[model samples]
Target chain A: MEPIIKVENFTFYYPDSQVPALAGINLTVQAGEFLGLTGPTGAGKTTLALALNGIIPNFQGGRMGGRVMVAGLDTAKTPCARLAGVIGSVFQDPEAQLVAEVVEDELAFGLENLAVPREEMRQRIGAALEMVGIASLRHRSLRELSGGQKQKVAIAAAVALRPRVLVLDEPTSELDPRGTLEIVALLQRLNRDYGITILLIEQKISVLAPRVPRLVCLNKGRIVADASPRQILAQEKLTTELGLEVPPVTALFRMLRRAGVYHGDLPLEVDEGQRELGRLLGSRASRA
Target chain B: MPGKSFLHKLNPLTKVVWSLAVITLAFVYQEPLPILSLWASVLAVALIGKVLREILPAIRGLIIFAAIFFLFQVFLIDEGQVVFTLVPGTGIGRITDVGLKACTMLALRMLAMTSTIPVLLATTPPKDMIVAFVEKLKVPYVYALMLVTSLRFIPTLQEELSLVIQAQRAWAYDLEGRNIIKRFLALIPLALPLLLMSVQRARTMAISMETRAFGAGPRTSLHTSTFQLLDIGVISSCLLLTAVLAVVSLR
Candidate 1:
């Protein structure tokens, strides 16, 4: 099967900046895959996200090399508006992204821009709100919403366009832990049930490692690591060198293995770690 | 939220028209009677709308500004017969009857005419103001959205600016204890970072707008702004009264 997104030797430099924001980067995302992207600040995560939807070379003018293709269309050639149907981008700051006053109006904004028929727009808005679990907030003012609700509304606004892929750039950076969980869970649901390809840039390793099967790590505008979350977290030296925190569960497992107490592969999630620990102790007790 | 007073029931555009009527009528005649009467009518609307309390704060500031303007006109202009000379010898000594009359007319017109703004603001939310711009003023929907977004960012930018100022103060930058020029000069450090942040915000918002297909096709709003019968009545009466008053003043 063809990948939903493909970036080949992609290198980009901002205007008047010496260092390239993204340098010789190669990446691929399959349809319906949940890919987590993480790196320190100014690590080119946002630049890469913008490139996926053609905002880089199209909307934001910069020196660029190589190509990025989304949904069979080259991002360099396609205008950001045309790519809107193929890629829905949820930005970091929910407040900055919201242009409407009311929740329902925010949802309708994208569909209206896409010129969907009035009847169709209403259905899509309803479906998007229901899917985001914010149907009751449809008529409420955006000002009165909690941070999580506002982010949900932002997600609804993007999803209303029914894009093929969703790109979120640090969506939960401004949200609380519970709000972060709601968004992560929402992304999981979108990936699992709707089969929408999700590219999430998140810093919360514990939250991201458990959910996203694949994690891509960027460093200094380069894709230094691309593997399963388990594999990525197991490389203690690489993760530390790149300034990424391994999930606490994964770190504990690694420490146990290093101390010669446990002999098993590193688990990226808490439940998996718990199971591993239980089995290790049970076997040890049996031998004793 | 505005109370369900008769004025509140009128569309925001009707209120805007009423404001324009007051401003125009205030400038149309040199006499203070018409302007004061117009100002009283606006006050009555504010009172009935239960927004008098909200509007008073803005009116208070306007009164101070008007007072300073009145003083300038009465002392500086020297357009009519001399009335009083408190200072006796210098260029700023004389006060004239015509200057006093002009100052009173100008200040009262300014005070009364400008007071309508506070009334409108007290009665209309920013969202309704954008709605009025979109539906009544025929501004493009995207531009209307920009207006709303800008209004939303004002408080956010203010907060961010304060943080920036505080951060600078922590670095031992003397932002206080300065003359007017020096204080403004001290703000340069604040302004640079603020401008950069504002630009960043604008850029992010623009990118977000594009990703969501902001201008991809014909747009439709969830809440359609339609004028009520009350809006129509208010608008017509306001225009008729203004026109009649204009003709009378001209005569």
Candidate 2:
């Protein structure tokens, strides 16, 4: 697969701070890939995410080393406004990000700033609302929306710009379980159906483990682990050392494996664990 | 506040012009009868816009202020026949017929001048107002956006203030059972957190706006405002009323 994003030995230090926010980072995201990024608080997850779209070096007055390239544009050198066409970013707080009073107007705001034609802006707004399944909310006030719905509008606003990659920085952290699920499902659909590359940042891995095929763990401003979700979750010791919350299902399967009662790969999800347990019981029944 | 009446459909600039005209006419006319008619005309516009019910509270507030103003002005002016006196031997609280008439005219003039605001606000959305300022008046979009965005966050900040108050209360901080001076001092704790949070929110909002390519180049709007026949009619009528009032007052 072609790499859409490439980070090479990138190091960043925030203004007025001696400590580096990110250090010695190297990562590559392939086209149409859904990658999960998880780390504990103060682990530079947000800094790396911001670096993807030139905000770290451009908008933020930070000293940095190395380069980040998204769709062949060097993020550090490219203007943030120009890079906005290639990378769409969604932040954690939906309330803070919204700029318009109404839903459709919110989507139109970015396009309007980009100098998109009125006709094209309208079409993109409609298509994005349809994709997010919030067509009925097109006329609703931003103040009237729930947190989940507001986040969805934020996503739709970003998606309307038709960027090649969408980077969400803990978009579900402020939402309820149902809202989290809705966002996760919407992201998967965007990645699978529209071929939009997604880099989802989270504080926990449980939600990401089942949905994302690849997982990257960050620690102390460095890339600590980069592998498949199964491979990453199976290492209970490493995950515990990293201070990541292991999903309950993955934890149970690991304990079973330790006791020599179960074998094979650990399940990352509940249904996968159920199937694994059923196969183990079947083998024992046959022996009996 | 968002409704589809004649005033609502008119261009925002037209309403702004009408508001200015009403304010000008109130200032121009000195007689009680003309000023009272001007106030009545503003109320008539509110009735036509179907916002009279919505603006009743604002009207009530204006009435209370006007009444207070009347009380103060009526006692200060001592002209014409003395109508009533309180504590008679000292002329400390004496009211005369001319003073009564003058105070009434002044109060009515104030009511006429200020009441146009609520009618204008009730008919036009803030977005439309900003757009009119940007497109027609040649105001820069960034400044207009700043004005509207600050207005938008007022309610959000108010909500945050209540949350901070509640959080402080949870810590057994008594805000209500205090003297007036203490109550004023109690707001410091609540205000500090809200101020810090607002600064943080402002930073986030700026980043969000920049990421969306705000100030990238020339921008366009989704909804464009064009002056319709109703807007022209409203504008002409406002001009005519202003001219007639000027002429009548000078005569």
Poorest lDDT segment (10 consecutive residues) of candidate 1 chain A: A109-118
lDDT at residue A153 of model 2 (Cα atoms): 97
Which regions in candidate 2 have their CA more than 4 angstroms from the true location?
B1-3, B71-88, B91-99
Predict model 2's lDDT versus the native.
0.90
Q: Per-residue alpha-carbon lDDT of model 2 for A104-171, expressed as tens digits?
A: 98999999999899898899999999988899999999999999999999999989989999999999
Provide the overall lDDT of each model, using Cα atoms, as 2-decimal numbers.
0.87, 0.90
lDDT of 1 by residue, A202-226 (tens): 9989889888889999989999999
User: Which ten-residue region of model 2 chain A has the weakest summed lDDT?
Assistant: A202-211
- Per-residue lDDT tens digits for candidate 1, residues B88-108, read 776666888888888899999
Interface RMSD of each: 1.6, 0.8
TM-score of 1: 0.93
